[model samples]
Target: MAPYEVLYGRKCLTPLYWTELSEKQIHGVALVRETEEKVKVIRDCLKAASDRQKPYAYLKRKEIEFQIGAKVFLKVSPWKKILRFGRKGKLSPRFIGSYEVIERIGPVAYRLALPTELERIHDVCFMCRCCDDIVLIIHM
Candidate 1:
């Protein structure tokens, strides 16, 4: 268990934790607090140090080289079913199909050409470079 002060300061929680807090009112507050405390500690340590040189490291945008006709599987996130009177709807499969890369918009983001069925549902979906899960960017 973390201290109360420490539990008062986090930016975000893990994806697994979202389910745990679905029914709770003040969900993730404790985790946020803990994150804040950790940040405070880091800040204090940095202030005490005379040398304030190197900046924080972050992921740099990598150059993506892919052809327009590259066939890539677009990952999708799970849909949460609403429970009404103890009845639930079936959840759709996470990744529906492999989409052809229509165009490269940005380093990480891309414009995909999906099937007609999926096309009727969504326009463009965002691809996760790290994970296999893809999210529906927008419905067209």
Candidate 2:
């Protein structure tokens, strides 16, 4: 039984049947055809929406890779009342380095030669958090 039949003690009215109808009044073959048509229409609409969204989802994304010994700027997240590398405030820089890439830990992670001040923090960072020093010119 459908949830509506269990909860309200009656079958729910669908788009095809706004009024209550007995099982004898509806034919199985016709109901199956209508349901298949509705499902096809819903699937087509979902595909259209997904296609329209695909380009924007990848607009700013590109494959990023770095070799060992390459220089990169590491992105930093600021926290309230907590200092990072002795810098704090709304005006502080969002990224720090030209840190050398010591090793490529994985496809998307790189280990950097961070300064002694940042020894407490982990050295491995994802590609998104590290920007190539050469590409920094494009933004300027």
Candidate 3:
């Protein structure tokens, strides 16, 4: 059986089985046992695939850790908080604030000390937007 059938607990009807009919003799406890075995096999295969692909996924990625009081710029997602009161969002800067990191909520989330002006938005933000150096002046 394919992994799809094993995980989803359903038989896949493909062109290979177009002319075949399901065996009606297998029933009751036997059918339940068969399904259980398929589920076990599916779990093992999924874990193996994840282990094999994990290293490649992190090849070029660098993990960044933020400490309390560290300054970071909050990314401006156009969908998250709309700023189109009167001006166009395309003309607005893509990022806002060099806010200080006030608290760590979880492994990947942080709470920033946003200004009173930005009290409307949520305090918690992901680490992907926590950049230290806003811009390094490159001397031409």
Scored by lDDT, the top model is 2
Query: Alpha carbon lDDT of residue 84, candidate 2?
Result: 50
TM-score of 3: 0.56
**lDDT for residue 7 in candidate 3, whole number 0-100:** 94
lDDT tens readout by residue for model 1, 70-97: 6555655443212211224455434434
Number of colliding residue pairs in model 3: 0
Candidate 1, overall lDDT? 0.54
Model 3, span 74-130: residue lDDT tens:
765666435433334576545566778888878767899877767877788643444
Per-prediction TM-score to the true structure, in the order listed: 0.36, 0.46, 0.56
lDDT of each: 0.54, 0.70, 0.67
The best-first sequence of candidates by TM-score reads 3, 2, 1
Give the lDDT of residue 47 in candidate 1. 84
lDDT of 2 at 137: 24
Model 2, range 58-105, lDDT digits (tens) per residue?
999776888888777776667612365454776666666667888887
Q: Model 2 has how many clashing residue pairs? A: 0
What is the descending lDDT order? Answer: 2, 3, 1
